[model samples]
Target: MIELLVNLIVSVMAAATPLLLAATGELIVEKVAVLNLGVEGMMLMGAIAGFAVAHETGQLWLALLAAIAAGMTLSFLFAVLTLTLQANQTATGLALTIFGRGFSALVGAGYVGIAAPTLPKIHLPVLSDLPFFGATLFSYDPLIYLALILLAATAYFLTRTHAGLILRAVGDQHDAAHVLGYRVIRIRYLAVLFGGAMAGLAGAYMSLSYTPLWAQDMIAGRGWVALALVTFAAWRPFWLLIGAWLFGGIMYLSLYVQGLGVPVPSAMLSALPYVGTVVVLVLISRDHRRIRLHRPAMLGRPFQATN
Candidate 1:
């Protein structure tokens, strides 16, 4: 039983990798009040771009870099519209999704059916050899480790650093941040770009590590799941980790249960993620206050520096 659970956890851990990367990055973006809803689109673009680059060059690293670059570059369009032109953030973000999807299909057509390169899994010297925790925690791809590190670093940055405080301030009150001599627009630009890069990386992971193949809309709605996780996690890094794991667990278990022949159809198994999402959302809605307190007040709002 324990071995089964461990194996299940290992598989779930792999499933959560991209979510962790996406949600973590989105968490940071929201912390600074730049809610980029284009995570899914960005991820899809990254998946394809990264796959194409890696497939052609045979260099996984370069391909991943190209994916992130593509995601970030595409995100700049959102930044310009929402930040510079003062368009609605939510609308612009959605449009980005549409654009990314089509662009990925157009540019990614030739690369269809090509195999993706995967990141190498590392075995921690002593830890990986340990009975349980080692395999579950230490035995994973480097990106998995990087995702974990990012969670910790983000938490610390949000709670401990001066710049983090300023970012939060900007997010909470752009006018106030500007009065305090902070560059609100500049800070938001950086935050959004950071978000785009992370979202891109998450997409790249899906292409390279998760499936090692590029499919049309392979990222599916993981980007949306990521968006939901930001709220599910109550905008906290630790919460993001937990949320990713919970979602990953649910998703993994949903598919695994089908293997158990529990009489559930495979078709129904696919709805598990979305169903869990709805149920969790309803649970959060019950509290209401909890979400308001944790949700960044400036999320989805545009910032202007009026000093």
Candidate 2:
């Protein structure tokens, strides 16, 4: 029983890593009042790019870099359309996701079913040798740790730093921020790029670390889940972690239950995570006041500088 429990905990953490990474980035983007819904597309692009690079080059770091670059490239395009040309954020983001899905499918056609090297786990000397705690906490790959560290840094930057305050101000009142000499568009561009990079990293984690293979549409709505996660977290970093874990556990439960020979249809089990997402969204949506209080004032709204 203990062993089974330990394995479940590890699986949950691994499953949660990508969501946490992607949501962390989106949180930053929304904090600056820019809504880029291309996260799914970005993650798909990253997955293919990372898998291709890893399969050909055999370098884990290079694969990760490729994923980040792919995500950023898509995001840069998004910034140009939404920020510079003042396109509709929602439509552009949806289009980006579609493009990412089709493009990644084309790029990954030849690499299907090909296995690639997975990320190596970093086992600390004494700590990793400890009891159950060591396996649960110390036996994760670098990306997992990076996700946690990134979240911590983001939390600090958002709540404790002057720049965080500036970001919040920009999100709350872009016109006033521009009047105060803050380059509203530029700040949002940076935030969007950062969000893209993180999304890409999340994709890389899925390919290079999670499954370690190339598969079309393997992101499987995780991008959308990550978007929902930001709202579910109420745009708060700490709560984001909890939400990620909750969803992660829900995602992995299907597999664990199947392994235990539970009497349930496989298809229904696979839908558990998404179903949980909808249910959670419904519950959270009930509190309109809470969402209004925490949601970025300028979210999904286009910004223009009158100069």
Highest lDDT: give the candidate number.
2
Model 1: per-residue lDDT, tens digit, 173-231? 88888887888887887888888888888988888888988888889799999999998
TM-scores, one per candidate:
0.95, 0.98
Q: What is the lDDT of residue 45 in candidate 1?
A: 89
Predicted candidate 2 versus true structure: per-residue lDDT over 13-109, tens digit per residue? 9999999999999999999998889999999999999999999999999999999999999999999999999999999999989999999999999
Shift of residue 286 alpha carbon in model 2, Å: 0.6
lDDT of 1 at 274: 91
Off by over 4 Å in 1: 131-137
* Candidate 1, position 223, lDDT: 95
Candidates' lDDT values, in order?
A: 0.86, 0.94
- Candidate 2, pairs of clashing residues: none
**CA error at residue 159 for candidate 2, angstroms:** 0.7
TM-score of structure candidate 2: 0.98
Residue pairs of candidate 1 with colliding backbone atoms: none
